[model samples]
Target chain A: MKKLINNPSDVVNEQLLGLAAAHPELHLSLAPRYVCRKDIPQGKVAVVSGGGSGHDPLHCGYVGFGMLDGACPGEIFTSPTPDQMYECAKHVDRGAGVLFIVKNYTGDVLNFETSAELCKMDGIQVQCILIDDDVAVKGGGHTSGRRGVGLTVLAEKIVGAAAQAGYSLGACADLCRRINQNGRSMGVALSSCIIPEAGETTFLLDNDEIELGIGIHGEQGVERRCMASVDILVELMVEHIFSDPEYVRVAREMNSASGEWEDVQLVSTPFSRGESFIVLVNGMGGTPPGELYGVYRKFAELCDEKGVSIKRNLVGTYISSLEMQGCSITMLRADDEMVRLWDARAVTPGLCFPSCDDVTSCGTSNAD
Target chain B: MLTKKNVLIWFEKSADAMAEHKQELHLLDAAIGDGDHGINMNRGFGKLALELPVMGAMTLQEIFKHAGMVLLSTVGGASGPLYGTLFLKGAATVGTSEALDASAVLTFFDAGVEGLVARGRTEENDKTMYDVWAPVLREYELCLEAEMEFVEILAACVCAAEVGMKATIPMLARKGRASYLGERSIGHQDPGATSSYYLINALYESIRE
Candidate 1:
């Protein structure tokens, strides 16, 4: 309610306008709201992902040289409609094809599925890779299964790099699926975020309480308990992620041959000892960078004690939940290929890796 | 006793009802879900209202199809596709018809409910809009069998919808965002079910007017 905005209804439009103004490399469209990279490679497979607006630097920030080719942002905490995705894909798709990186919420899933159907009807080859890497929920209970969290940022980068390397649409989708299966994330929120239109926080917590395993939409977490120190919180989240059971669920994938959705069974492999990991300690908007490093420091110590090697690490506010004060930890079991892909240079408004050309002069700009 | 003009008027009344109860629906949704059902429904219906002028010139099936497209494109949540599919499938049942009677109305509701079930994959007692829609369809069938007047049958259906909507208050949600709350989801009226009751009540009001 106390945020800086002209009007509640114009929040998304005005914010998108600001994004376009700040980032010259991105193009914004109004009739159907979507952000696309201005200089998309001529024939490479296009990667597109999007969700609600509060999770900024997510679907849109990842749109650049080596990330998503386009993103379709919906209203606050609402999934984007099929028209946005369909039109964005049409605009971005070259001769090769377009890949949709969808999160695993019911509205998102249904809307993207409809978009894929629409694209296919127009003779564009579309493949969808769903990310559901949050290990908070045990299974696909009443609501859709595990919600996509921090792992989405990593998926966009890795899959975007693969697409940049001229991988086929199928190959990019396959790699995205593998990344989704190999990663796990858990989060805890100190407080709830206020949706702009609602003009109130979604939920309330006491000063000494924290909600554990929260989705990004400001939904109530799975469990609430007395607040703990940063070290203890990180340890708790790490333990949950490491000890979570192998998750198996039914997912829908588009069959390009038949142009229909086919049910595909997906399994998330459990974390094991002696595996190398790409650890991401992400802030949920309100948390400071120094605190995130504190989280990373404790998380790294716990991983070392558990015999898991940290192959690579990123600590920042890459994915957010409005201005909610919280952080999430994502761990991807990294193989040689994943490591290489993760290391690939990328330049986007949200994430920028120092290129070989700039490293000599810039001396490593702080990406966070 | 139902004409294409009546169907159009029903849609207009439904939109007005959604606008009137938008805040009430949001309050109900706030208790368990993301709390935007009212806003989403109002936006969808508002868009449909804009197209009403064009829709008035079309066949009944065409009007329903156009309304479904508008809802699908404008509404941004689960209700978008659920309600969109309802209208689309209902449109298929009355292709190019200028008017319909009690049996046709029954077929329309049956197809719409079937489409909702297919899209949402929800069973009975999931505490969704389906709770109201399924019962209203059943009551409509019963009223028809008893040879009631058209307006009387619609009134009976609206009453069943109201009863079904209130019945969701004590039921645990097994689908959509409300399901995330587990046991806490009980004791709150299902927002989607409430809007569905408004829609049915609007239909009754339209015919009586």
Candidate 2:
């Protein structure tokens, strides 16, 4: 109930104002909450992505070089109304077509579609890419589909970089598809979050409780158990994600399919293997880096045990819940060309590729 | 048969019931939900009150249309869409006539249930609004099949709704936020289904009076 803020109701708007002030290089529409790069190229496709406001350093933080062209911010944990998204699309449109990057939530998908209609009315070429990377919720039903979480941030980064590098609009979109196909995320929550406006925790769990396979919005996880060791938690998550036959099958297929991959250890400027990938150990909210890194350590150990090579490893609070204590792990298999592109230099507040000297290869081999 | 006065009466009754249990509902939801069911429902129907007076001699559809708009705009959660769609679809079936006879009322209820299903993707055991609505809809059809008097039919549907609502207490949630609780959701009555029962009870009291 008690926190630092001018008003609970004005949180989103105030945060948006602060974000714009802090990141002067990013362009934000006064209304409709679109955050894009300051300068959008003419005749180049613009990528528009959005959702509710709680998950920071996402949707908006990624609105810089090599990421989203624009983002629409809605109320906390609530999908932006169709009106907001529609206006954002209209505002972010350059001569080139615009693609809507939407999460898989029903309301989000529907509202984005509504905005797409408005885009179409203006004769704007619009396509939609839905990110459904969470493995928590059972999928293939009329609903209860997987949620879009960490992978969304990855998609914006990779695809945004591709688009900026002069890939055709379709090619940029194809990169997005490849990212989604190769990526999967799963999370667990240690505690609940207090929504500022509501002045109460969204959900309550006992001191010994932990929720496995949780979503970013403080939604309950698929399973709850007594708090376990960090190693145990990572084991469960890694087992659930890696145990999927499809994930391995897909990785093997992508490994062979992405023929033009560069070997990082072999050469400084390797050609495209198109097989580089990323693993993000995302923090839900209240989790501290020390704790997050503790989990990441376990993740690295597991990947080593499994022989699943990581193209690049990113661990931090990239996507989050509303100050909830938890973390999600996402794995994205990249082709060698993709690995090259991932290595491509880009600058954003949240995402940064350190100098080559700063980076170190963790796994023993590409197979491992 | 519900005259305009009766429709207004239903809104008043539901509002009263919601006010009485608002805190309890909030508490129940706080356990495994976002903890705003009471406030959200209250805000939604509270707006329904102001519009009803000005909507003089409005038909069931018109009254429901107004309610739907209020719910959609004020509730601001999963309930917003579920309840809003219910009223919106209900309004689609009944026009702006000044009164609703028993059969017309049943038709509206049927439409509302359909809308709830379509919007929420909830099924019989999902521990949601559908829990209250499913049995009531079935009883309503049963009453019509038996050719019961309109009064009897209304009473039967309301009773069935109340039972269904109470039955949610022991049910494990399988939809929406509650489903995340898994087995932990077993003992708590679904907050959404509880409110839905209040709605049906309100309607029964108004029409009967």
Candidate 3:
């Protein structure tokens, strides 16, 4: 119940204000509450994404060059309202168009869908792509579908790079869809974190137990088990993700041509040997890097044992569950194009790639 | 007939109900979903309670639309968009009239429920707010077909919503965050359905006279 704060209700707004002040590169709109790049290059397809506020260094932190053009943040652990998304898209959309990268949560899906409809009504071209990359939730008729976790970070970076490279809205959306279908994530929680509003931990775990397949929002995971060695835990998570059966789920997407929403069947193929991946071993805000590296050390060895290649690796607390003590592992199988885009130059508060090092790779060598 | 004052009273009562039961809703959600349903619903409805008085000079249609936008702007969750759309789409069924007859009430709920279904992509048994909304709309239709008074129809809706809310205790959630629990989601009443019941019940209490 005790944490540093003036008022619980004003937490989100104050955080946004502080972030806006710290990051001069972003344009912060307090009324509708969205953060977009101060200067989106004219005619570039605007990439926008948003969700609840707890997962920091995510939607907003990723708002910058070669990432997202804009991000709408909602209350802690709550989805942003449609007006936030609508206003953000409107602010960021240049003459080209706007692409909405939505996670597959019901709140995110509903709010973003409504916002897209509103944006389209204003004659702003828009396309929404949903990210569902968590392998923990079994995909079926009687489930909420898989939750979008760590892969959202990857999708934003790759899709953001493509958009920055002057890809069409359709092309950027297609790349995002491909990334979602190719990635899977699983997380484990040593303990749950307290929500500021509730002033209590979300769930209780015995001293000798941990929750497996934990969600990012402090929801209960699929299973609880006695504490085990890091090696065993990491291997178990890796196996669950690598051997997940063909996942099929129906997602609602907007059909730009007909201006109506349509159910699109999305499938994620199981992982195989010899595949390359961009892997992320993320912390849940509480875990320190020393421990994260230990987890990654075991994970990297496991991938090598399985004959899979880690083309690029990121180890940090990029997305979190507000001081929850846990970590998630995300692995995205990347094709050549995806790999190339992943390396494209970009700069943001949470993620950074200096273009000063490489010239032609970012296509900046051409006459501007 | 249901007047704009009755509608405003419904919102005010809903705000009070959510505040009174905030802890209860939070407990229900904590069992299977994130423990914020109570806080979220209370925040949105409480805001509406404050915002409703300002609509005194407006028509019923304008009131509903303005209320929807306020909820849409303030409530930050699945319920925000769903409940917000319920009002916005229902406003489409209402005209500039400050008073609505029984048929108008039926038409309004029918459109509102349809919007909830579309927005939530939920079926009747999905263990969502639509679970309560679906049965309430059906009860409204039955009451109207039976040539009942507006008060009678509201009573039927309140009862139907209670039954629907209780029915969710055994449902395996097929939508929203609770569905992530799989079978673990059973044995608890849905928070969304519970909140929805309060809303419908509040309407009956508001216009009991």
Candidate 4:
């Protein structure tokens, strides 16, 4: 367990200090900890999302100009408490309202639900959107349904863009839900990750085996397969995503009108040929950009083979597991609204899709 | 009646219990769920140990409420909410009383298990804390019906708690992260149930002493 740290207990805080120093534009609060943008525009619908802390540049890093207004991170792989979420919503709420983009983990769901109740009690108009787009999960009877994975990154972006464009709280919540319904993600882990306090690998695996259907946490995936080449790996994952049946699950959303939680039924249509996709090839912490591009290469080649169009793509280590050596791919079947939202200008500490608004610095007109 | 002093002792003793069994719980969960149950439990109880002094002026219900709030904010995993809900709901049932009688204790435990069922969305044989809690509640109720003393009722409940903890070894998990393993989750004792056993047994020990 060789790593850089002062103490196991101080890992999350010390690293968050580093993040605050590196990106001074984002505000950091240690007590009831959460990070929000310093210069939030007035009257914009606030978008807040968070989960466990190990997945960096995710909920926190995506807080900036055109994305999330704030993020509340929990312990390494634990859900943040309701106080943090409640405080963040209060800090970021600018009279329009706040929307919480929550993942589908049991702890996360419960904590966020508790936070929504608290916020509603205080007269805040809050709505929640649950993202459960992992295609690896088949059903949702007695178990927690699909785990929210890579698609969360897309949701924060697209929904953030909608809010920036003056979408109301209900409209932003509905748009995020629509994005969730149109996405699927699948991950494979080649190695186990260690939590800072645990100081041990989460799972032991053979040198020639890979874990499939993995969530971002260090938990073991659903299936283990013998290792294969990158092409075969990407092909297997794409099949897992494309062939997944229509996923129907019941998720709770806070209804602002009645101040009640409604069990909403959501269905995700399976991927098919001739469909266009906004694709993401995400490295699970340990994989480098060069290898991710290698994955994107195979993924793009497969898309070409299947006659599916790649409308927009991001190949990076964005949504990550904590130092796990593998990659996950997310494909959001695109509509015109989502595509346009994807192209919106985003400038966060973790992600940057800037529009370069200052045209005067360009066009080679320096002689004037 | 369980005194406020005994409630504080239970919390302080449970902190040590969590620390003592931390490694064992971590190893058990490592085989099935993510290996953090022990760490989360220790973290939450360690805070409770420190917060115990400030709760001196509070009633039995207030102590439970404070403990519930501490667990809710400090513990991060699924165990946090489940245990937090247990204490908070238990506090609501015990009322603002300075002491809880034997039946009040039983009612307290029942309310907690009910909250666990509602929050975890779980049932019997789901390989959850409910596995241990359900049996403990049943045994406590039976002992009370048979007109046992308070000490004897707690003793029976603790025994039932241990049996329930062991009963999870053969369960095919249908909830939480262990369910992801499908068949592979079998043969491992559940970490959540084990921690619950420690806490429940700690309460009985505190009262006995």
Local error of candidate 1 at residue B141 (angstroms): 4.0
- The residue-by-residue lDDT of candidate 1 on B157-198, one tens digit each, is 888998999999999988888887778899999999999999
Could you estimate the TM-score for every candidate? Answer: 0.93, 0.73, 0.94, 0.92
**Model 3 TM-score on chain A:** 0.95
- Best of the candidates, TM-score: 3
Q: Estimate candidate 3's RMSD in Å.
A: 3.1
Rank order (by DockQ, best first): 3, 1, 4, 2
CA-based DockQ, model 2 = 0.12
Candidate 3 ranges beyond 4 A from true positions: A1-4, A354-368
Collision count for each candidate, in order: 0, 18, 0, 0
Give me the runs in candidate 4 sitting further than 4 Å from their true place: A1-4, A139-142, A204-208, A354-368
- Which digits, one per residue and each the tens of the lDDT, describe model 4 over residues A141-244? 55678889999999999899999999999899989999899999999999988887878887777999899887788555558999999999999998898788
Docking model 3 quality class: high
**Local distance difference test values of all predictions, in order:** 0.88, 0.73, 0.88, 0.87
What C-alpha RMSD separates each model from the true structure?
A: 2.7, 9.1, 3.1, 2.9
Candidate 2 per-residue lDDT, tens place, A129-148, comes to 66777777653232345678
User: In model 1 chain A, where is the ten-residue run with the lowest total lDDT?
Assistant: A354-363
